[model samples]
Target: MVKKILIVCIGNICRSPTAENLMRDALNHADIEVASAGLAALVDSPIEPTAQAVLEEQGHLPSAHKAVQLTSQTVNRADLILVMEKRHVTGVLGIAPEARGKVFLLGKWQEDREISDPYRQGKPAFVHAYALIEEAVHAWAQRLVG
Candidate 1:
């Protein structure tokens, strides 16, 4: 049983937070738990405003999102870890080498794609990132739950 999921990105503000919320919404009734963290987090920053707005448009709330740094403890706790890009997976493995097989691109199931970061980009980039997250999370939820 895949009980715990961890979503990862460069910063917790944009990609990972959105993926976390989308997974939470999709797996609402499942026994799994979902959370997100950053490769290089801001520590105390809230989710980016653009990310929050994009999630809201999808009827998901990101108000509780808080930036967290990826750590060994979190890596050990998660049964699965979905990362925004291949570089994120590489970076995370450098920190927690034991998380080899369990870490993968968020778009791995769909043509082994990578979700690009929209960090300082404008609204359009944020929208694109959000759409990718939503699609990946939905597919992940379906496969894990069913």
Candidate 2:
């Protein structure tokens, strides 16, 4: 059974962190750990303001998450690494070649889409991305819990 889930995106402040926090809230179990990292991390940066606002609106926990770089160690610790886009899969594999079997798109089951980056984009963009992350996380939770 899966225990650790690592979510990935471009910067960790926008998409991945949203997925991480939402998943943590949804799963709400101590045995399962949810975390996030970035391909080109903003390192030490907190979750984007608009992203945090969107999460707050949804009644999810507002995380004070610092951006972390994706590393080989992080890759190994994760039982499942769900990335926001296809390119992220390539970057993670480069860090830990053996992570192949465990990595997947966050939106893989739902049309295999990419959750867009909403860094400089306005609240609307963040809102839309948050919705996508929520949907994707719920889909994953159902699958993983089974």
Candidate 3:
């Protein structure tokens, strides 16, 4: 029954945006709207180049993402908010205390694993993160659709 989903990470230019686009592609549920934001956003920054390249290599079209800061209003709008790390969940709660029930780790089903930041770590790091995100996205998609 989740009508809207928000993916979150620290910067929005890496993990969150990657997960956002992948989830959008995987879900295919017309009623579910997916978006992303950063706890401490870069504000107007695009997806990190290495991250974008990893996504493209995996056949996921990178969206025209502009980094956005997470706000209470954004949290309220999402029925579900998937974050990249445990700290991000805490950060989101700090923004919207009432969002406690809606927030979760993107890797919730994958042993609660956290997707690490790959900002300046180059393509290898981005590739590793991409695999994790893709796996998590599929897990979520199955649960969401089933």
Candidate 4:
């Protein structure tokens, strides 16, 4: 069984954090850990407001999450690293090539999809992005845990 999961994106304030929370909620009963990080994170910044609002609307709380950077240490710790886009895979591999096999697109197990970033767009865009992340995370939880 996969004990640890790391979700990755660009800012860590949007997509990855949502994915991480969704996965955590779905796998609440499972003996696994879930976290999130960014390739170009804001270091200790809080999650974006738009992202937080969308999550709250969906009954998921994301107000306490702070952005974290992706590092070799985090990469090494995760049993599975689920990225938002294809470039993230390359970027993570560049940081830790040994993590190659464990890294995968969060949406890959579903429809070979890519979850687009909604960084500075607005509330609507963030909502759309959250929907995508929610689907991907739920699918992952089912496949990996259920």
Give TM per candidate: 0.97, 0.96, 0.97, 0.96
The per-residue C-alpha lDDT of model 1 at residue 96 equals: 95
Deviating ranges (above 4 Å) for candidate 1: none
Better of 2 and 3 by lDDT: 3
Residues 17-94, model 4: lDDT tens digits: 888888999999999999999999998988888888788888987648888989999999999999989999999999
Query: Per-residue lDDT tens digits of candidate 2, residues 1-146?
Result: 88999999988889998999999988885479999999899999999888988888888877689999999999999999999989999999999999999999999888998988988989889989988888998899989875
Tell me each candidate's RMSD, in Å, in order: 0.8, 1.0, 0.8, 1.0
Off by over 4 Å in 3: none
Looking at candidate 4, the ten consecutive residues that score lowest on lDDT are: 55-64
lDDT of all predictions: 0.90, 0.91, 0.92, 0.89
Indicate which candidate wins on lDDT.
3
Per-residue C-alpha lDDT of model 3 across residues 40-79, encoded as one tens digit per residue: 9999999998888889988888889999999999999999
Pairs that clash in candidate 1: none
Q: Each candidate: how many clashes?
A: 0, 0, 0, 0
lDDT for model 2 comes to 0.91
| Residue 108 lDDT, candidate 4, scale 0-100 | 90
The count of backbone overlaps in candidate 4 is: 0
lDDT of 1 at 139: 87
